[model samples]
Target chain A: MNESEKTRRKTRWFMLGAFVVAGAAFALIAATSMSKNLVYYWTPVDLYRAGNKAYGATIRLGGMVTPGSIKKLGGTAVEFDVHDATQHVHVKTSSVPPQMFRANIGVVVEGTMLRDGYFQSSRLMVSHNNEYKAPAKGHPVDQKTLRKMMESTEGIKD
Target chain B: MKTAWIFVVLGVAFLVAGSYLGLFVAPAEEYMGNVQRIMYVHVPTAWNWMLAVLYAFGAAIAFLFTANAKWDARLEAGLEVSTLLAFLLCCQGSIWAKPTWGVWWDWDPRLTSVAVLLFASIGIIALRGFVDDPHRRAVWSAVATIIASVDLPIVYYSVKWWNSLHQQQSSPQTVSSQFHLPLRLNAFGVLFLMIGFIMLRTRVANMNRARETALPPMTEHAGEIA
Candidate 1:
């Protein structure tokens, strides 16, 4: 075929291919995104609205760990409940908790919500907000007090 | 092409046997409980995706430098297989995430980057469809592959480099630990399946290309003497 003819042929094939791919992609996206029951994340509202139905189902519940609610049950076992302000889901785990799992820090608990409205957690994770650490606004290290305390304790031997 | 089935068989065998061993033989994770068993399959899917994407990147580079038609087919095969594996990886992650995070999906960096990469791969194949000339299509796709390479590192470090909840590599990922055997087997299983996917996809693309080229000439020759 001549040069222009070749270019025309190329264009046709390109269009043909594009059409096929586009159709396939549109279908896939539609299927995946439109999964109304995807069971991905449960907001406090979702948990409340879907309460009990969410029972026995494994899920990731996002919320702030309730302050003053963290109570150690034993050596390693601790009980804490998460709330997105609308609903509270208690979580129980027997492992050392993440530093971010304290009051007010956002946490995602992975586990099943029991029929008793508590989340029986197996994993505890903290979202380290270290990316946006601002300079310390409060008092710098209390170095003077530390020096006095250290001097007084100097008489002790390990 | 038929021989590619061997890898599929081998992959299924390894995945099943390794899963059984990892789930039943290994001691329960002290911290994560039975749900931790999901890690075996989840990790392997990520491994498969990485390897497949790496292969695509290399194939694209080869196409750019070698003027070889074969590399184009290979690149397409790599992308197709990797895209599927990536999809599976995300799904397995969701399954694991549900039990571990109490949610199936979240807005974490790792999750976001993977979603982007998957969409971009879909775009790449779509763009490939729009290119008519084989040579131009190859060159264009090579460009796409190179562009998509950025997503790899982003996904790899999404958790560490950002304020994401996803943990760093699982504790005891070290090969010297009890995970050594199961991990090796899982890795090998994923590898075999990946290669099998590439082989099968490449064969299909090759057959399709051949059919296109084999079409008879449009015009018949006229004899002057007649």
Candidate 2:
């Protein structure tokens, strides 16, 4: 082969080696740091696990809104119990919840754990699941009845 | 080119059918009601956007190995199409988020990773434009694309690995059977449209490259003088 061809071949090999090395380094960094850094919200279980650290510090706590636990305490203030499988946290928020907020739906509330034992949230956001279920046959589709139907589906896993 | 047109026609037909089913025929969701219908377009766009990124990554690898201009053309096409779809995905997600999540956007892992890759692809495309030499542009962009594509797996697994506000992926197993037809239809619709866009874009890139390599009249005169 000519000198130019030899140099071209060498360059290709160099490029390949660089890519492999860089990729490996990236993988190492990402694998170590991703889990700790990428968490968008903590669960009620996570909050409990944190214990003393959980109180007074602002953090986002995500869980399902417990059925029959949502209460409108006059005006925009509302209270609900956010629960995972084994643990639950009472949440009080002054912010208006999203229209989609309903019983048994996933939610992420951002605020601090109060000394009084309830989560005081300034912002409340709903976290909808991936499952999309059509209303049952002959079920009323109005907003009021639809909400009631959703409430009734609580604790019933599909 | 003809094949691309055929794909376009098929894509449009599927989209029309899918949208009809999603809007009028499908039953309202139990919780979100009519707002949930946004998934018909949003999810499909997201799925197809990932496919477009994969296509670009493959093209980038092939070009580096073979140094073929055709692969470069295909890579450009894939990058542009991926960007378009990514933009669409974000817009649709935002519209869906406003009513459902109470926020138009959030810094969740899944959403953040997607936004990162979108901006990365755009930067790579910009890199292609600044470099004047065709071969250098191709090589640099190919390398950039490969690097950017490392994020693809991260984007896919972000929801699974992290406490994301975004939900897990939906599939036939997770979704109700009644919602299947429209979802599948739109998925195929977006897939075909993406394919069609890439094919046409590839032709355009090839033509541009050809023009760039073509000898100018001034160059011919200079050669004679030399």
Candidate 3:
């Protein structure tokens, strides 16, 4: 081949090699990062199963709030138990919980599990259900009485 | 041309109506309350941006195989739309995150992958501008597009594949049925607008290429229209 043709061939191969190397490097980076950084939402049972592995790691715990397990600790801080039927994890949080937080509701807490068995939560999120019911007439939607009535009837045939 | 204009009008109307439904008609989310309304715009933009990238990816492959100028034109249009939508998605997500996540942004896997997607796509589109030769531009861009699209799946699966502050992907199975209507409406609205824009922009790209390559005459069909 002529000098120009040989140079062109070299350039083409170089470009191809560069792209292949880059693709491999990216795939490696993605795999490692995903494995290390992807935090799965664990239930109380999952947390218990994790045992020592669960301690001090920032993890998300999701479950329904155990009924009658809520307590106000004088300020924005609160304590509750999140249960997934099989296990329950006690959670304490200084942060104000979401407005929909309540007993028998699904929630996800983000924080660390302490040696004393309490989950110290930095954030609390209530997992809202999919049901949507219109408010009743003449009664304000925000009225405590109306909300209680709606909650009582929710999931039950009227 | 008329059909494209009709699409624009319909898209705007549906988007407005969907916004109204989301903001006023839909009940405040039990948990996030009123702030969840942002999902109307944010989710739709997220969905459409991926679709735009897929379009560009398909166009890139077709251009490489067929050496068709039309596919090149479509690839350009798709990239332009995807770039715009990706930027919009970031903005909307930031707004929603502030109240919900307590932070505007994080280096979480999902967010990082999406940022990579936006930058890589933008880079490919920008590279096209610097190349002057139409044939060279087409071939180089097609190669770049295929490489860039490797990020698309990473962006989509980031939440599932890694621990992310961003929530998992939502669908009919995951999202509340109540939110479905407005979400679908706005999704279609954005889709129609995206398609309309792509159609018009593709024509412009073709005309520009025709002007550049055609015999330097007023005899060229595109030149007469121009």
Candidate 4:
């Protein structure tokens, strides 16, 4: 190859090497710090594990709303137990829950754990699963059936 | 060029049929009810958006290695189409989020990573417009595209790797068989549309590049007047 062609080939290799190095560095950084920094919300188990550290700091706690635990304290204020398998946190929220909010549905509430016990949430949001099921045979699609379906958390895990 | 128009026609036909099935024929979801209909469009757009980004990444790599102007043209087409799909994906997600997630937007890892890549692609497209030198523009944009595309894996795996509000991806195994027909149809529809758009966009990019490389209009008359 001529001198110019040789130089051009060397430049291409250098560019390739730089890109590979940069890519590796990016992957390394993401792998190391992503888990720590990218958590959208903490589960009920995470709250239990935190112990005293979990108190007083505003945080988002996500889990299923326990069946039969939904209690309406008054207008726009509701209380429920957020459960994650073995662990559960009592969450009392003043904010109005979404239309889709119901028992045994996934929820993420943002607030602080009070000293007296129970999570005091200022914001409440529902998190739905990926599954989309049609109504079973002979069952009509109506408000009552939809409510019942929302209340049943069968085959779903936190 | 004619073949590109054929793909566009096929894409539109598929989309119409798929949408009819999704909107009228499919059953309402047990929990979400009719709102779940959005999934037929949203999921398909999301799946194709990822493919568009991948196309851009591949084109970028090919251009860098071969130093081929054709690849650069394809790269530009891929970037623009990816941006369009990403924008649509976000809008559809936002609409679905309101009733279900109780929020229009969230800073969760999955959503955030997608937004990051969308903005990165836009920035690269803007970079192409500012640079006058075709060679420098191609090389710089190609490198930028590859760099930005590192976020693709992160976007895909965000739900699995992090505590995201967004649920895990739904597949044939996860989704009910009854819902499969519309989903599959829409997926293919969007794929065809994306491919068609990319091909047409590539031609436009090629034409633009040609105009850029063409010699400046002869200035002999102006020189004589001077």
Give the winner by lDDT: 2
Q: Report fnat for all candidates as fractions from 0 to 1.
A: 0.04, 0.60, 0.12, 0.56
lDDT by residue (tens digit), candidate 1, B1-226? 6678999889888988888888888655433456666667778888889889889878876766665667888999999998898899889888766654555677666798899889888899999998765667787887677667667866786554443556555444222255556766887898888899899999888887677557654412222335
Runs of candidate 3 with Cα error greater than 4 angstroms are A1-37, A41-46, A49-53, A56-64, A104-110, A123-158, B26-33, B100-113, B129-136, B151-181, B207-226
Clashing residue pairs found in predicted model 2: none
For the candidates in turn, chain A alone yields TM-scores of 0.67, 0.74, 0.62, 0.74
lDDT of 4 at A19: 79
- Of the two candidates 1 and 2, the one with more favorable DockQ, higher being better, is 2
Tens digits of per-residue lDDT for model 1 on A3-106? 75664455445444544554565455445445643333465567778856878878766656777899998887788877664567788876567533456555
lDDT of 2 at B92: 94
lDDT of model 4 at position B184? 81
Model 1 interface RMSD over true interface Cα atoms = 14.3
Q: Supply candidate 4's per-residue lDDT for B198.
A: 95
A11, model 1: CA deviation in Å? 18
Question: What docking grade applies to model 3?
Answer: incorrect
lDDT measured at residue B95 in model 3 versus the true structure, 0 to 100:
85
lDDT of 3 by residue, B1-226 (tens): 7888888888898899899999888877655678888999998999999999999878876776666678889999998989999999999988877776565676666778788888988898889998867767877887787777778888887765653556566658646667888888999999999998888888889998997787664443443485
Cα miss at B15, model 1 (Å)? 1.2
Cα lDDT of candidate 3 equals 0.75
Comparing to the true complex, what docking class would candidate 1 get?
A: incorrect
**lDDT of each residue in B1-226, candidate 4, tens digit only:** 8888888888888888888998999988877888889998999999999999999988988877777789999999999999999999999999998988888888888899999999999999999998777777888888888888888988998877776778877768657677889888888889998899999999999999898778574532344566
- Interface RMSD (Å), every candidate: 14.3, 4.1, 7.5, 3.6
- Which candidate has the highest DockQ of all? 4
